[model samples]
Target: MHRRALLAALLCASVPAVALAVPAPPRRVVSLGGSVTEIVYDLGQGGRLVGDDLSSLYPEAATRLPRVGYYRAAPVEGILALRPDLVLASENAGPPQALERLASLGLTVRRVSDAPSVDSLYRRVEQVAEVLGVPQAGETLAARLRAEIDTARAIPAPRHRALLLVNRSGQFQAAGRDTAANALLGLAGQDNALAAQRGYKPLSAEGLAALAPEMIVITSASLQAVGGMAALRASPGVADTPAARAGRIVPMDDLLALGLGPRLALAIRELKKAAQ
Candidate 1:
């Protein structure tokens, strides 16, 4: 068994029941993560979204909301200008001080978990629902998602070694353990090619060749960044890989694959198909 399988087993076995928070529902809300925005929309509280951070581009409506800068670099001025009473942020959001400033200014900032695991995904939905003052809706949505996920997990996908690549400054960074891509691949029954490592890291050409991924997954955004499939396949190490020779490169939605949002089941299914 690979490292990711053991990690997944541990993660699934160890996840505790998430505790939901209780807070008054706000009339105006700003969401800082794509997953959080999707959860808010799933909870039937789309009308409350007055603003969102740069990364909350999902469900069509979230893209129309006023932008408050990138999630990691939250701009207090941009958020305050929206006059939102509640802010739903991913745990990865902000430089810390921005969140503190918002809280200090009497804004209700609810930090939703952004851990790239199944339990954390569920926790995010419940957190958003609780903040929206609708625990029942959260429960209902979570149950449906759980059912969908269980069905996807039972699909019996091939146990191929898979690599999810993201382009960063012209270098290809392979997704490793603790990444959203890693968690999704494991759930989809694919072995993470870089499971021995943690986080995305730029790989040397020899390093990429050695991992020997059977399938290569890249987000649409990353594909465009790296100048499309031909260019990607022609990249130094990839050209010598079995995946490249077999033409098993797949491009998918970044939000679904990496955001670990409401479409996690779909992401799993897509990955399972990619593994074949």
Candidate 2:
């Protein structure tokens, strides 16, 4: 075969054709991302959700729905068990094989981008709304979100140095650039203390003091893991930081602090308040 033709054939062979199609308004839908689920509820069309991935917990009602598995590693069998007519996945969904299995088996899977940004969030809301057969609601929600985001951005940020941490198995992981936490801090006009690096990294006991952050942020779940504010303040090197010494450690709602979704403006406002 010609070189160009060979390359083209190889590309086609390597990529799977997974098309998403819904002939009518879907009566049963499975949401794979928290942001997607949030948009569905915000669009006032939560009644169509038959099941959700583990990451879809929000709005209180989402927790009560049957869960397939975590969005990032959803199980094919688990998703199949729900008998959904449409599966709306976020950009972070699946172990690749599971999603491919679903698609190859004829499940209509629509993937929405969950990139951390106001524009992306607005697009996500619109995408979810589109998939749910509520384009008007999606447009309205997107416009409202855009206006609220603009209003939030209009407020000058305090520009305080902030450090966000995730506690995993008793170990502290610092949020760096490209993370949801860092994005929120940036939008709120705060500097990410660990922005010198990309993605979450383990911080040494001595590192926090040297960074000298004005505020230390953590998720509510992480706070619970380390036994709350007192425990976090007592952790190694934590007390040495100006934030800890000044009692500036604050834990925010897990989803609100970490997920980019319909409540982004609210999160930004809360982050701004935390810096003060």
Candidate 3:
């Protein structure tokens, strides 16, 4: 079996059967991840959200809630202050100590895995909804998301090598295999130009030139960091790339590109269009 499939199966089997039978749905909830927050809203339980991590910027109203801090560095005190009956977080959420502290305080903290793939995304939505006592909503949302993603995945593949990168000052950070960006690129029918690598890492001028990607995908935030699209093309090392010459730079909102949330299908479609 595929590694992700094995992990998903193990994750599903590990859930306690009795937990699915919680007597009362949590009325006060704190979300500690962007995708977790989006799933809550998609489940139609946004009103229950009393707080969220800084990453929860989608759906606008989520921004009005008190922030507990960044997902990885959340403070237990801020979360406790929200008086939440339940906390929905990404598995990657936390400095272990803070989450341990929160758990010790007698709070129910449910963690959804952060692995970003169509299967993982479905699992995350289901996990969040189930913990919120809305399993049926989760099922429906997951089904819809799966269908939409399948449709997006059906688009004709563009036979082009594309590199998704983040530029900081003129240096580049490129996405590699097994990352959210790489998964989304495949879903959008573009081959990851940096798939030879395993994760994100700095891309030197020589490295970027060697990759010779036909297209470059970047986030709006990264574009701003290197002085916008025009400046990006003019930057040293990047100026020589075929992608820069062809103006094949695709810039998307960083959140949408990385969140792997409810809007993932939309992101995939947009990227596919850009690649084509």
Local accuracy by lDDT, each model? 0.88, 0.85, 0.86
Which stretches in model 2 have alpha-carbon errors above 4 Å?
1-22
Question: How badly does each model clash, as a count of residue pairs?
Answer: 0, 0, 0
RMSD of each: 14.3, 10.1, 11.0
lDDT of 3 by residue, 1-276 (tens): 699999999898878776777577789999999888988998999999999988887889998999988999999889999999988889989898888888898998888978967788999988888888889999999999989988887877566788989865657899998888998888788889899889887998888878888888898889989878888898766788888888888999876887888899899888878776
Residue lDDT tens for model 2, 1-276: 699999999888766543333267888999988888888899999999989876676899999999987899898998899998899988888788888899999999999978867678888888888888889999999999888977886786567788999888778889999888888888888888999999989887888778888889898889999898887899887888888877778788878888878888888877777666
Model 1 TM = 0.89
TM-score for candidate 3: 0.88
lDDT of 2 at 257: 83
Question: Alpha carbon lDDT of residue 205, candidate 3?
Answer: 82
The stretch of ten residues in a row with the least summed lDDT in candidate 3 is 14-23
* 161: Cα error in model 3, Å: 1.0
In angstroms, the error of model 3 at 150 is 0.9
Ranking by lDDT: 1, 3, 2
Error of 2 at 263 (Å): 0.6
